[model samples]
Target: MSTESATHLRDESGPFFGEFGGRFMPESLIAALDEISAVYEEAKADPTFAAELAELHRTYTGRPSIITEAPRFGEYAGGARIILKREDLNHTGSHKINNVLGQALLARRLGKTRLIAETGAGQHGVATATAAALFGMSCVVYMGEVDTERQALNVARMRLLGAEVISVTTGTRTLKDALNEAFRDWVANVSDTHYVLGTVAGPHPFPVMVRDFHKIIGEEARAQVLELTGALPDAVVACVGGGSNAIGIFHAFLDDPDVRLYGYEAAGDGVETLRHAATITKGRPGVLHGSRSFMLQDADGQTLDSHSISAGLDYPGVGPEHAWLSSIGRATYLPITDAEAMNAFRILCQTEGIIPAIESAHALAGAIELGRELGPDATILVSLSGRGDKDVETAGRYFGVLDEAALAASALEQNALDANELTDGEAEAGELDHDAALTAAARQALDEASSRVDDLSAATGNGVER
Candidate 1:
């Protein structure tokens, strides 16, 4: 069978393939998952639930994000036509809100009083917090200590929205660590708290639930593309962090046999350096973060810390759905390096006036490569997963504005810089003066971020008060 038929052959009901997506949680949480599953099943069948969600989408979360044609960026891809699903325009500034809102609604239906989630880049944290605030539910977010520090602004954003942020200092102090903390919290508080997973990974219900929530991305884009150009796209492209956005768009195109699907994973420094997060492209089957999938591990089967310029994709294992998709030959997984993603980041900024989250840049980079192969007439759709506001400092450092010499002298130097080593005048003249530039860059970043957020809010009619 062709890839399309194979994907279509599988129904949305039961019979999850190969035990890849069965509930693997502690016995305590099984009842909650069962309750959630039942509620979801009812919601799926009931027109009232569907209408309410549709109303929220139309008024709260923004359905039907725009499909923008990137002509200039497409030129580098051998003149192939390239379009972007502007999920970055979604409320909370990423594709994350789509899943969060849906799950939050599900939580409300389940009669849960609190929402809990784990985050790395803080995008999901912010989205979850936003939903909780909207629904008037209590919220708690667990983030790795390192991520909390690196993404302090997001931490503050969540706090401002009345969500509690706990910094997990265990393990590698990243997404996995935060996830461990969240899982522990879930096991302890499963009855009253709903764990809103950010991606289509995780155990049983999550892979299916998150995917169903995100499927709107592809559903809306499919119709939009057809309306805009009168035909199906030649291919769909998305960055695969936990494979949420990729699966979202890909699910819609699964039955469209001619429409190719490509998912790009992060290759932090360089895959050749062995210091990367290209899980699907450079990993083995192993268990990590509550799911069995492609994982970066050592000879002893111990999980390895992953590196990526994009914190969102800095994970050692990918979503189980992605693993199954790859094994079934339904989708192709590729790796995009930090350098390539950064380059694409700048290209989108310069050419299209769009600054995508570093994570989304990976897909943009892949689009460039695939476009070249497809040439000018072919149409490819890429998901602009989020905005880049949360990554200015990292991007500046990667782009050399915050290089070693500058870091040694800047305000960010702080404890690392010796005050006596440089005179006041010298310190003032050197990296410290870079503050104005940093501030300007930060403002621009935030402005871009808010614009995307507003676009999503407007589209979804979510009416984000922020």
Candidate 2:
């Protein structure tokens, strides 16, 4: 085996990739990350941890997630044979549970009683809550108020799973703000609480720890794809938010110099529009959330609000290792627009009967481009990172696929009926008969119209007839 494969197959001892993976945190949290890292190192070596996690993988998270060949989707991509690692099919509906379960287990080993985390689109929050519930630990999720509104159902799901949901109302009230709140909470309650950082970003041990937890994705994909095709894929593609899912699959193929790795970032409106979250493509070197990496900041060193149809990819900074890899040209970073992602989202749902998360659709979009380039002979593997349940409403509204005109017509119809009722008021005045009935009927009609609008909104790109 090559050195990289040997390092990954064995227990992750000393950081394998580079200096990008280490423990750099506040002095207060340093000892905790150190302890956690040490325990994780030992756990990897111990057959018990391996067996336990493997059991959970088979029984709970459904390990060996299928690698699906998308023949129809591939047809548009230059006839390149495209395959997808269906991480979207994992328990809790995403690859996030992989890392959370490992961390929760580590928390048990460390005797931590409480679990805390920050969420962007609520996928990580839901995954963390699921692990906390399974482990019977107190779980607190900090979500930006804006994200809370956008992903309200996921917030409710987390609460129903026995997690305390805190809506952060700080700067911009988004993922970064929620992360700031989580860091503050960690600093304050470091003794009893373990901060479950979601991605392969943050500081030091986090990138390494989370990457180790998720490396199973690549491990399985590498073996499965080789078995199915008798050769490694030409390229591996994944979306980069905090870079966990991308790193998860990319790490295993690092030794395969013939295998090209591509990471897709969300280009909210467009890169030049100054409204995108394509950090690796357009950002400058800076430190934002504890590590030095490419960050979207203004001339004054102030971080800007990142835009994306998918809330998960709307981050101002990318993972440090991704930054290092980009610098060394080990991987290529590409940006996908909201329109292209939405189109891919519709295509996946229509073609494969799968509705991919908007974030994951970016990778699908990249696959479309790669398919065109590689042609029919090559094979590409894309990580379907998460599900699309959280983005249906947003996608509906963005594409003008919702029945706004029908809703407006219904509203106008109700208003006309109300006007006729007022003009034909022929009942008792003091007893408030006709006017009251008219007002109640108008409100009811308007509510029904609004309901139609909501229904239309929910139906967008769902492959449902209008």
On TM-score, the leading prediction is 2
RMSD of 1: 9.7
Q: Which lDDT tens digits does candidate 1 get at residues 211-261?
A: 888999999999999999899999999998888999999988877879999
Give the Å error, residue 399, model 1. 1.9
lDDT of 1: 0.83
Off by over 4 Å in 1: 1-15, 401-466
Model 1 Cα shift for residue 214 (angstroms): 0.4
> In model 2, where is the ten-residue run with the lowest total lDDT?
9-18
| Deviating ranges (above 4 Å) for candidate 2 | 1-24, 400-466
Question: What C-alpha lDDT, on a 0 to 100 scale, does residue 269 get in candidate 1?
Answer: 84
The per-residue C-alpha lDDT of model 2 at residue 407 equals 53
Per-candidate TM vs. native? 0.84, 0.86
Worst 10 residues of 1 by lDDT: 457-466
TM-score for candidate 2, please give it.
0.86
